[model samples]
Target: MLRLLFVGDVYGKPGRRVLAAQLPLLRPDFDFIVVNGENAAGGYGLNRESFDLITGAGADAVTLGNHAWHHKDITALLNDPRLIRPLNLPPGTPGRGAHTFEVSGVRLTVVNLLGRVFMDAAHNPFLAMDELLAQPDLGTVFVDFHAEATSEKAALAWYLDGRVAAVIGTHTHVATADSRILPNGTAFQTDAGFTGPLHSIIGADPDGPIQKFVTERPHRFSVKDGPAELNGVKLELEGGQAVRIERYHYEEGGDGSAAS
Candidate 1:
């Protein structure tokens, strides 16, 4: 069996801090580590420094979401094979959205796809996935479906059942309660959730979102402070099939509070 740790969206300084502190204790238990860091930079987009923070904290590969290109310099980083953006992005999009890595004699391929429902315009994730899976034998395929709609995420999971090892959702910041193996052997979760301040609204200061909601206007958002938390999933795969998918949660300062 091979174990992989997939961390949900990292919000900002709080997320990175908790991750750096907790990963050292968690690393020994997993064979591979992947983190979603699209919002790592000031809770908007990933900058070079924030990217380094995530990788430095122990991410083998970093997956991104709709905020993938918020940082202008990230354009240059599109060439880095370890950084993956959404595959459904236009053909000319700077970064590639899928990558394969070999670990401990086992090959694992990770793909990122963005959902069109309630999201920015993008190609069809189902068709894009079909093209990727059509390639000869992509060993132990795992997908990070960065999407908003729960229905869309679940539909894709069922669409690719047995064809991939796991399909975990992101972008919603709130982790879903559903985590189980599909009828066809695929491990599925609606959303992996966010790994950052838990007191605020989805890692941002609650005031901004609340005010915006009341006024129906844009407001400058900022990363929230206070108690931080780390949310993620641990997958146990046997022979390129997911046999177990479990949620992993950790609180800042190690006082021990499960992710809510």
Candidate 2:
């Protein structure tokens, strides 16, 4: 069996600090670790420094979401072979959507995909995935479906059932309770939540989202600091079938958000 650890969206500095503190304690149990780092830089886009912080905190590879290129510098850094963006992005986009790694003598392919429901335009993820699977199987496969809709994530999981080992969701920042193995043996989840401040609205200061909803006015939101939360899932894959899936959350000792 191969053990995989996938952490949800790492918001910003708080998320990075939590990972730095928690991963070392959790590292002994997993063979491979993947982290969604789209918002690791000030909760907007990831820069090279944030990328290094995530990888430095024990991430074997970092996956990105729609904000993959929020920082212009990321375009140059995407080709580093460890950072990945959405596979369904337009052709000629910088960086790869899928990455292959060797862990404990087993080859694993991790693919990042963006969902189109109420999201920015992207290629058909299902069709793109079909094309990817058309190639010879490289190794155990996993996907990070960074989407907003649960139905889309579920549909993709069912579409790839029995083909990949797992389809883990990200971008929602709120962990769902539907962690289960599908009929075809692929492990699935709607969202993996987030690793950042728990005292905010999905890692941002709640005031901004609240005001935007209440007053219908644009307001700048900043990543909250203090009392970081780490959310993720641990999976056991055997023969390309997920045998077990578990969700986990860790929080620093505190309750309130730190002053901005």
Instruction: Kindly provide the TM-score of model 1 when superposed on the true structure, using C-alpha atoms.
Output: 0.96
Candidate 2 segments exceeding 4 Å error: 255-260
Looking at model 2, report the run of 10 residues with the lowest lDDT sum: 251-260
Off by over 4 Å in 1: 253-260
Please give, for residues 1-260, the per-residue lDDT of candidate 2 as tens digits.
89999999999889988888788778888999999998889997789999988888788989999898789899898978889899997788888999888888888999999999989999999999998888775589989999999999999999999999999999989999999999999999999999998899999989899999999999889887668888999999988889999998787776432322
Per-prediction RMSD in angstroms? 1.7, 2.7
The CA lDDT of each predicted structure is: 0.89, 0.90
Query: What is the TM-score of each predicted model, taking all chains together?
Result: 0.96, 0.96
Count: clashes, candidate 1: 0
Whole-model alpha-carbon lDDT for candidate 2: 0.90
Give the per-residue lDDT of model 1 (tens digit) for 162-244: 99999999999898899999998999999998888878899989999999999999998889987888889999987778999
Candidate 1 collision pairs:
none
